[model samples]
Target: MDDNKNLFKQIQALYRGLFAFVVAFALIGVGLIAYMNNPQLFTSDITASETEYVPIPEDDSDKIEDGVHVRTGFVEADGLMETVNNCTNCHSSELVLQNRMSKENWIATIRWMQETQNLWDLGGNEEIIVAYLVKNYPVIKKGRRGALTDIEWYDL
Candidate 1:
């Protein structure tokens, strides 16, 4: 009879512990539901007068040139955003601005990047990007300075 009573007490303690655990879990669940239903209840409110405000002076250096994007310096034209998004991800916009090339060269460069640099396939955006680059930054005829016209020979 004593052994039986001890076993019953042990079972009662286990049931009580389980009930407490379930109650704790249910309370947490209810708290989460309440929070999910109305989270603004937990957020603090502040009046504008409590915070300090400062004004920033506007600088126009980047925006001086018309049709030039202030941020990337990309010419404002069709396909501008596409080129900026696709090309500027891996490298800076300055790189694109500097390397002026024809459409064929741009295609070749893109292919090279894909083969070596793990650049993703651009699909239709390739044409747009190449067009934007070729339009805005096409190759300039750069070579040795014009033939010397009035150069005098120096004595050895």
Candidate 2:
């Protein structure tokens, strides 16, 4: 009975070792498959020459009426990039888009920001940014929706 008990204990230990080996083998196989799929994950060496640089076009004519920019969603115009760099630094472009104020109002808003919101002086770039805002997004009179036309009313 003592010999049988010792044999059972040895068998259990062997099974546990085999299980652990199988699990380790599976993990290694999974890692190998992942590496095979995308070897770039394992590669740490990246050369500077491999990096890509996109040049900004000198011509503004194509972009003037080319519609809104994909990333910023700012209307395409002469000073689109300038406006993006300056305005979007502080707040979201949506804040600019939603309020279609005139040049004077825009300046007032800028002044208010400067006084209260810790906005820095824009200097000469202010002209470009303001021009972009005024020309592209002038004050729109959206008083009310068209008089609730074509609606069927039920009697209470």
lDDT of 2 by residue, 36-90 (tens): 9988767775774477787886764324335877557798888888888878887
lDDT of 1 by residue, 45-89 (tens): 475446777778788644626888778888888998888778888
Identify the runs in model 2 with alpha carbons over 4 angstroms from their true place: 1-66, 142-156
Name the TM-score of candidate 1: 0.50
Clashing pairs in 1: none
TM-scores of all models?
A: 0.50, 0.49
Model number with the top TM-score = 1
Q: What TM-score quantifies how close candidate 2 is to the native fold?
A: 0.49
